[model samples]
Target: MSTQPPRLPPPAPEDAAARNMRLLVLLRWLAVGGQLATILIVHYGLDIRLPIAPMIVVLAALVMLNVMTWLGHPHWPVTNFQLFGTLACDVVALSVQLYLSGGASNPFVSLYLLQVVMGAVLLHAWSSWALVGLTSLALGLVAWLSPPLALPPWFATTLSPVYVIGLWCNFVLAAVLLVLFVTRIAANLRSRDAHLAAMRQRAAEEDHIVRMGLLASGAAHELGTPLSSISVLLGDWKGEAAIRADPRLAAEVDEMQAEVMRCKTIVSGILFAAGEVTGEAPERTTLRRFLGGIVAAWPGQVTFEDRLGEDRGIVADRALAQALTNLFDNAAEAGASAILLTAKLEETMLVLTVADDGSGFPAAVLAALGRPYNTSKDRRGAGLGLFLATNVLRTLGGTVQARNRPEGGAETILRLPLVSLALEGSR
Candidate 1:
């Protein structure tokens, strides 16, 4: 039998574009606020005779554009072309405002650089350069066509104290915005990279599990013949007249047969886990009965509690049963005198918890839980129980959590969607 991990799909470009579009919308709102404050200060505070009506019209148009973009954002995927168009609109709006104020002579004309920087960060090469060309053209048109601003005699020239102070303010605003927006964009990129890295790690772990399963399946196949031969020999000895006459001999033969049968059952489980057809159909049973069987079969001092109100029908999943057994084995190895198992249904999920009155997990083992070979045992190939259990639950769209109780001992919790094991047509 062979198996492979499910491949993870790469993130779509539209995802990043959509996120950047949101940033642009936020920046646009900031632009509106800044533009309004600047317009009011220049026209009223500075006593500058400016084209207030037309500039206000431009501001209103920007506000309406932002509103439309916000409303349509969820309905459509944002694309590179759309982002380019948004930047272009801002460029035109800024050009008109600059033209109304003082054309290229306006101190805030440097704001064009902010848009160019944003484009380079958020756009593709072609779009970034296109924005550059568009901004350059707008700058030239404003310089050539805009009417001169009627400034006070003291502030008439570009070298006036008030004009130099305006340039200083423009520099400050540009610097602040660049820092804010660029840092946020970088954070978005970093988050995407981290998510991709995690996906890669999970793929690698699943591949390792596949290889291990193949090896185990091959070993089980090789052991099957010898185990069957031994079983036949044990049966023959049990039937012998001498052994039947001797109670001690008969008891010994019976014990050997039982052990051999247990070994065969374990091999069958291995084959089943490898995705091989076991020549037997899965047993259909209710959740309550399934849990009861596992508890009754466990050869240990254990308690079982089922708080799952109404019973639901499900297929008997041998792999899941084996995973639970692995947890029980671990508890036994930890010197647990008694183990407690609890089951409950939380909406569509089945929640199971196993707790042991043994020494809690070591800090290092707890920290690296679910990782192969991460165990406190000094024996070779130890610590695979929890690793395999974790992977099995994960394959069924479930998760396992391990923690030490404050009072004492350790607890492991398993949660899986009941739909994964639900019988067909059984709610």
Candidate 2:
């Protein structure tokens, strides 16, 4: 037997800001490319007189910032501070480009709102408000300081129709990119949140199981001494000459002894099942002998049938025997006169089935067979048997399933994959 603590579930993940930062970085590159194209098209194709050298310098600075950002991406998580700074830098860069071109008169001025909207969606309220302030300051500074861009040579003498067309293009581009990117990022955020929520729920369930296991272990320890004393008293009564003279009294004493032993068995089983104590070290034994021992110990008539061609040797322990005993006990308690205990080899797995000739399990009981405090019995503290049995098998990488038989009674199937059991035994 191996003593081990209850396994805790893995921790829930943090927010999905890292991927968001990567997306923002990629979008920045596209913005840069778009800015360069627009600059070239207006200056060369449209024959507009502009300060090309200064505009190129600002674009170069933006590229270098993006490169540094991309390089540092994998090193740190994207926090609120990082996102705020990134968006602030974007605002500043866009402002500078707008200033170099046409200040507040630039058609791309609405692009500022894109950053504001994204900040509201992806960042804290304070950070989003901070971005709004920074953009407002940038707009004010650009309006007050920068010179307006000149129109094309042909339209220099009149207000240009091309400027109106540029405004329409900027509106369309901003709307399309915002819709596409924001929708995708929102979906990613939703998925990340859903995963984290599931992890949290699983963690809660694991915690509940751990608490129950600890409580069961504590109860077992508390009951040990009292059970031992009762066993001693029963043994003394059995040995009494006067009591032994009466055959009926002797049989009753024998029954009491058996009941006491069952109590002791249950105490040890609980502790072992909880992994609080390693009751006994595993021993090498044949499947037949293992199954035979459990069947012999059962209080009711349990018929054992081995369908395997040949019994194979494996590591066996008290926990495995106790679990099988629990199944048998459950059948007997359910008014079963006889239980058919069968063992067989199915491919690389060992299959054990316990079928009873009692009334079948209720739908509710069958549905929640192995869950703690979920049982058909009215006895107080009676449900832990199947629960402990299920957990014990699970620790050995096996599974237990219960269902009602169509003809009558209930059937429990326990399967242990040979490969996993071998691996466990090796460990």
Candidate 3:
């Protein structure tokens, strides 16, 4: 479906260096085999008198070039040196072969095109053009200066056309290989840049996690006293006889107490997670119940919807409830009154998405959303909320990705592997 050539695998630093070595060794053997077979077939079947000894010595030079190709990557200085050396050898070999086989009249003279093509494949554009010029001049010199050998009567008059054809082949092959290598180099640069960006994104996420933990721990400590006082006041108010007489007051008090308890529970959970201060905590919980609590606890008025597919779920530190609460709060602040949460299941894996019809991502927080220092909220948030969530998901062999929708709003998708699901349920 693509017009471009199939790319070689990404050459990341590592075993790739050794792989280059092995490849050069293999290429040397292949080139040697092809040359040896050609020489044997031409000598015996066609009786072409070539400079066999000089050709054998040139083959030795090719072997040395192979060793250097193994040591030098595409951009190394030694790579160009080997490329030039190989081109020189190719020209010398072609000249020697021409002198023996009747100069331009030789049946095999057209094959010199391969040398120029090989040079272009491995060299930069400027170097490739220089090599092409050298090739053409070499062939012309051989045709004019070399003494003509006595050939069979059938091929006597075709000498001029033969040399012209050889020159044309050399130039055409050079053009083709130049295009090939240039395209390969461009693709390599793009892939390397993408890999670098991913690494930087990860490092920023880690720094965010540490800062978020400290902030959550501090927030829990500060809220402890007020939550305790409210709990006692509500109990005393419930005991008053006037409150029992008024059903309306009793109901309102019950709702207020429920909300206050919810806030206390959320604060306590954050401390237990970030501060490691809980007595008993579950390692994992069912996705449905976990998410339902998150939506119910959000501080803003919003319609929340969910659709869990068959076998759809996730395994996390049960701390996922707090993580989702953080995300929901962000959506609420973005003026999203409605949000949708859904999960997809296919072949033992889960993909959960949280979507909101609010401004996709604030321009201010875009650059540092998952990082440790840039909080979307105007307050000093320390920006670790999403960072913590991503880590929790990663520990369970999952990932989190966020993207702004082309139409409007934003979505966060979490991909989870299910290999350890049964193991998680036990916790």
Candidate 4:
């Protein structure tokens, strides 16, 4: 099996409070602009006698506060308390404007509901209710204390249709703006949550891979000395006169030697995976030559077909070879007598297909092809062959897929982008 150092997932991103605060600041600017326009329309167009000087002072104070807020640590996370205080400031500003113009009789007096709705959507339940109470109290006090705004004679009448129409327009405008901002904000929150969840999953996967690597490395270290001793004894016996006299004894000794070498290779692979030792470095070779070399290493019968026409050079990585070897080993375990490997260029990608005339993977295994420990085999080994292959290929900007062949077998497809491989080599 290819021994790759465990892959660690990237770090989780910082919280979204800073971003949300920036967004709120922009929204507040919109609110300021809207209020300024409304004030101008009432003072000039309607020709009303109102305290423009005091009203302008209130607007200027709000604008200054917003400016300070913008400059103050834009990177600082906005907490619920901070948001609550900001909304409270807005409510106070609106109440002051209403008190000067027309108390609770102003059509824009309904704008208090905007702060209430925002509080409900953005703050904790208790905090939102607190804001509602505060705004309600402010509204009542304004109506009881401030003098009424001077308006056209037609609107002064209690039964005036113009007053009713103005209220209707305020209600519609408030409803539309509230729904629009709330929906957009809600979507932003959902997107942030989803991204965080995905990062958490990757972290879990990385942890599992790290634990597995530790176990493999420890086992390899413990077994290496004994396997080496066995090989030495086998070599000595093979060179003896008594063993040479008997063909059966010589054959058995040779088989033992081969098995010992296999064990050594396995231990080395594990050590390499632990990043404790470096194996053979990557070799520069054509795609056809690389595939041929790997297939040649297998003792079983394998049919190889290369249809790429011209030779395409690649850096041969030991891990890639080990990954493919693991796949072949799985195919052999599934009772495949002969395997077929075909390679071709699909656009700018190298597509290699490995097919075996064995019982195809069960439905369950096919569904979770590259997940670790998902296998039907009863063996000492974990079902990590496909998992390792998948990860290794993924690191090279490639993908591995498995399927059951209708012709009574299993097939694996590996697609690797040539450009990605070249880029990886350059790096």
Candidate 5:
């Protein structure tokens, strides 16, 4: 994650969707390939005709499907019903082989357990247990009611009842239990996968929105220069007032000037937050000295306090200092004469916290805090502060969250990937 982009242009939404789909496809195929290789070794290398041949074929076909999907071939993935369909075909195949080989006493008669487990993994709870029931019934009926064929070249003349009972206990009961727990594991996997997909989607969408805001901010900045020039000319003309003293005209003109100035300020803030204009990277600043430097630079009236971890540190990008400064300024604006800051290392993550005893986020701005066009800063361009902070952190493989403290103040928590801390430590 530390190796992650210091900045990223949010990827297109379509890429996110495709990426999730591909992950599932890859996982499915990997499972199929492993299973098939196991089968090939069992059948060819060992000459054991354990009646797993049909399942081996199934695994092989699944591998092919996975490969095709990965190679840009699109088809619905193997859903529960498809898994069931494959098993149903296998059941028919095995049933015929059972009749030809040795009926219920055949060692391979236990392979129905495989189908039961597979079904359990993909189906809902009720459906999974139902599949288990159906499998038991089918295998039981085949053993009980169906006629037994002659034993194979290596099997018994006739099957003993004890042998059949033992087979049932070993294969059937174990299969049932296997399906039960495997279903649980698979269900958890499905839920976890869903959660991961949702998280990625959120990150992707957030990235996209931020990129759009950046573009809009850039445009606003470009527009600001001309708007400011026009505003200055309007102010100069307003002094003359085309023969002096139309109260309505003067008020309207003043409103226009204010609006123009607002646009200009907003654009300037955008440029600043974007790091569009920056001085050379200052002599490499470590997390501790850099932040200390920031506090040192704060105005005398405000107490800019900071603490850093012994192990965790940041390289302190030239622009990153400004980003951190913006956060401190926000604290100052909140009427805080003093700000408390602390940095800590937790394993591979660096957490930076900033808190102001001053008033928490104002009620009006609380709802839209990180949104690009909103800011509590009364000045026009102040909205870009949080956005700039967010983008900087994001680019650094980190996160920033703003929340009002339950007791009284606002807190902004910044988390950076531990990779940066690791890099700093190694140095």
Candidate 6:
């Protein structure tokens, strides 16, 4: 049994894109800071003569772009193309800044590699490769057209100790940024993959439920004829003179008739749940009355607690009712003599909890609670009750969770939106 905690549903593609965009915006702000620091240190601290005016204008434009992106990101739909465009803008800004300083001679020219790496991770394949081409072209153009930097005599040559130190500093900055942003991007991709896997698992479970429902419906239809025949035979026997004269025989006939009627009821429920029978309208009742009815029908020692201060009208869902009944049955089968059921309204949700003094579920069963045939019971077809119940709740956009209580017993919780069962016009 795996003890992994439950995971929240995956975010939509747009949500993921929005998050990635925010990451880009943050990276841009960091770039702005790093560029400002390097420009100041070189122009003032190192006594290098740089074209400060035009470079400041480019830095200002980059700042404005970051501001606009941060403000407008949530208003528009985010997409791969949008991500590609954002990265392209960053590349353009970087190239312009480099052209102003020393073009390709600036050790910071290596920073173009950082943009390419980001594109590879965040953009579509074609866009990624296009960014590669764009960066390569920008580098060549800057090298060809820009004026040479007015460096000190000691730093004039590329192999000078001062030039070597500048290159080393640029390498360290690029390496740190890469480690920070790339890891975050990788984490986002992993999250998206996990969500996709969860969706696939849910699709598979739903398919399995459909197949089982069809089989159960067909079985019910076949059993209808034999059950009807037996009911008619018992009716005749009850009316016969010999059986009527013997009170004991008549009593036994009555018991048999009751048993047959119970079996017929079970078959009808199966058909109804499968949508094979839909002529009758759904029953409508109050929440309190509906739960009370279930408890009254169960032939066991059960306690009901209604923490819902006010009752709301609801369309009685027989499937939901049966699902709760299955929980009770499981409790009894697990050697529980007494069960406690509680109902309450939490915000817009309806919550029901069942706690029992039964031997709690085995660790393996708890680990694979909703998966079909994942049961501790040794008998054939013993696990379908919980499986069917779990699926029923899932169909209603609810979930069922079970765990062993530390005090010695098991607890199962069911939660669903109240709107799923609320009566029309009864808010």
Alpha carbon lDDT of each predicted model? 0.87, 0.78, 0.66, 0.79, 0.65, 0.85
Ranking by lDDT: 1, 6, 4, 2, 3, 5
lDDT per residue as tens, model 4, 1-427: 9999999999766555555556667878888899888889878888877798898898898889788878984556678788888889988998899899887578787888878787767776567668867876786677667776667896673424465455545554554465457656866888999999977875776677789889988989989989988988999999999999999999999988887887787688777767786456645777788889989877778889888888777776666778888888889989998799898998888888889989888898888876788788877665888888887787678999999899888999988887654525543
Indicate which candidate wins on lDDT: 1
Roughly what TM-score does model 5 have, to 2 decimal places?
Answer: 0.43
Model 4 residue runs over 4 Å out of place are: 1-181, 278-282, 378-380, 419-427
Instruction: List the pairs of residues colliding in candidate 4.
Output: none
- Which ten residues in a row are the worst by lDDT in model 6? 157-166
Q: Write the per-residue lDDT of candidate 5 for residues 221-300, one digit (tens) a residue.
A: 66877896898788786998462588787888887877777556456545655556523343544666766776665543
Sort the predicted structures by TM-score, highest score first: 1, 6, 4, 3, 2, 5
Q: Relative to the unseen true structure, what is the C-alpha lDDT of residue 80 in candidate 1, on a scale of 0 to 100? A: 85
**Pairs that clash in candidate 6:** none
Instruction: Quote the lDDT for 269 in model 1.
Output: 86
lDDT of prediction 6: 0.85
Q: Given candidate 1, what's the lDDT at residue 301?
A: 74
Task: Look at candidate 6 and tell me the lDDT of residue 228.
Answer: 97
Q: Write the per-residue lDDT of candidate 3 for residues 147-261, one digit (tens) a residue.
A: 7764446634655666566665655565556546654775687689999999887776666666767886887888888988998899899989999999999998898899889
Q: How far is candidate 2 from the true structure (C-alpha RMSD, Å)?
A: 14.6
Error of 3 at 108 (Å): 30
Please identify which of the two predictions, 1 or 5, would achieve the higher TM-score against the true structure: 1
RMSD of 4: 13.8
TM-score, every prediction: 0.64, 0.50, 0.51, 0.58, 0.43, 0.62
